[model samples]
Target: MNRLFVMMAVLLAGMSAYAQSEKRIYTKAERKSAEERKFQKRMETVMDSINYADAVKALEELDFVLEADRLVFKRGETAFVTSNTNFISLSDDNAVVQIAPFNGGGPNGVGGITVEGRASNIKMKTDKKGNITFSMSVMGAGISATVDLSLPKGTNRASVTVNPNLNSNRITLGGYLLPKERSSVFKGTSF
Candidate 1:
């Protein structure tokens, strides 16, 4: 009886080991999809708390446009000054936006200029009619701009304008951002 019980325990341990090994590891595609889903879910929850009307109201309190220029040395006697002007808008959801770089000004042009930055923990929500609203904490720059946006109904596409004050840094007029649909923005280009 002792011998039989020992053999039974060994067999059970082997079966458990096999079961553990059979557990599936997620493929790269599956992992990416899961991550995307989590991000979307988080965005939805954040958006739910947005108030589009108040966002619009706040825009009235802002200066509406800000311009800044900086001087930089190139190589030889030629120096260039880069000037940027931001037109901003606010949504009830809490989004800070900058005008998208256009044909001559985007990163694709020769002697291209790119300004890369990030804002942390901005909030947003869409109205029942599909108007989005949001706020943002401008990072790196000492100033933050608030906006109100009137987005198109039935779609996520909207025109944004921002007005920032650089009174703090006396240089960078900063604000939040609301991203447009990546697919639409990246159309005809490899993203």
Candidate 2:
């Protein structure tokens, strides 16, 4: 009876040891790769579920106003609202531009600075992923600016690059171009 008891105890101990050893230790790289694979799979599923045709149609019908948040200049970044009150409204045919200091705010902000322009010679293209690219010449106030804008489908965000003929520096702005319904509440509100 003692021998039988000892054999059973040995078997249980061995089984416990084997169970503990079954756990595998993963390296940091291996874990990261596994996470990346999971992320890719999730992205793939999301991409597949999206209706590309609908997205393209929505982008083609885009018409909204983009309010500038930040203005990137050669000197540095500045609060767009501080020295500028600018908004770009884009539709299928024309882009209406409104800028602050309507005169020409001289090189040092002494003159009557104008920021108004109208988009002409507009060219628009779209990619397979429903990203729209628009290039146009905005001419006004005896000055011209090349405006390049990108709008992604099914999103409220847009990116704009404005290269004015008078300045060597290019200004880039990013902001939301939400529908009129979404932007109305924020009208007359300042930050």
TM-score of each: 0.29, 0.51
Across 82-106, the per-residue lDDT of candidate 1 in tens digits comes to 2233333322332233333343544
lDDT of each: 0.38, 0.59
Q: For candidate 1, give the lDDT of residue 1.
A: 100
lDDT of 2 by residue, 1-191 (tens): 99999999999999999988857899999999999999999887666435333333433565555665555555666544422345555555445444442333543242323344566777779789767787778776544788887777655467778787887767666665544333431222111
Q: Candidate 2: where are CA atoms >4 Å away?
A: 1-18, 21-62, 75-84, 91-114, 179-191
State which candidate has the highest TM-score. Answer: 2
Candidate 1, 175: how far from true, in Å? 19
Model 2's alpha-carbon lDDT is 0.59
